[model samples]
Target: MKVAVVLNPIAGGGRLKRHWPEVAASLKRHFGDFELRETQAEGDAERLALDLAAIGFELVIAAGGDGTASEVADGLLKAFRESGRT
Candidate 1:
């Protein structure tokens, strides 16, 4: 599955940003290649997820806090609706 990782950089008060290099390396080691988007504002992850879905990614992994994950889910659902996905 082609995965998309939506990251909320401010999730843990910037911890994700601080340790992203290590986390990214680990993801690359495991997942090989994934579409990664670091959220800059509140709704960035959702927009990113919508964009990813618009292009038809098979899998999308929203890596962030509850709110961020929720936003990504919302975006995916919106895209699904717009695309007529069953």
Candidate 2:
């Protein structure tokens, strides 16, 4: 499957960034290679997610806290709505 990971480097007080090496290794082991997109600010995750979905990625993962996940979901939903698939 085509997979994309939208990451928030500063989330959890930078805890996610600290552990990302191991997390990425595990994901690669299970899912093979994936596209990784790091968020630079509040709206980045949403934009990344929307673009990934529009480009036919089968999976888009939000690798951050609740807010990041929500943004990714919103983006995907927006993509779906725009495509008339929702």
RMSD of 2: 0.7
CA shift at 6, candidate 1, in angstroms?
A: 1.1
lDDT of each: 0.87, 0.96
Among all candidates shown, the one with the greatest TM-score: 2
* lDDT, candidate 2, 1-86, per-residue tens: 99999999999999999999999999999899999999999999999999999999989999999989999999999999999976
Q: Look at candidate 2 and tell me the lDDT of residue 57.
A: 94
Please, what are the lDDT tens digits per residue for candidate 1 over residues 9-41?
Answer: 888888887898898889888888888888888
Candidate 1: lDDT of 39? 88
Which clashing pairs does model 2 show?
none
Q: Which ten residues in a row have the lowest lDDT in candidate 1?
A: 56-65
Worst 10 residues of 2 by lDDT: 77-86
Q: Cα deviation of 71 in candidate 2 (Å)?
A: 0.2
Q: What lDDT, from 0 to 1, does candidate 1 have?
A: 0.87
- On the 0 to 100 scale, the lDDT of residue 75 in model 2 is 95
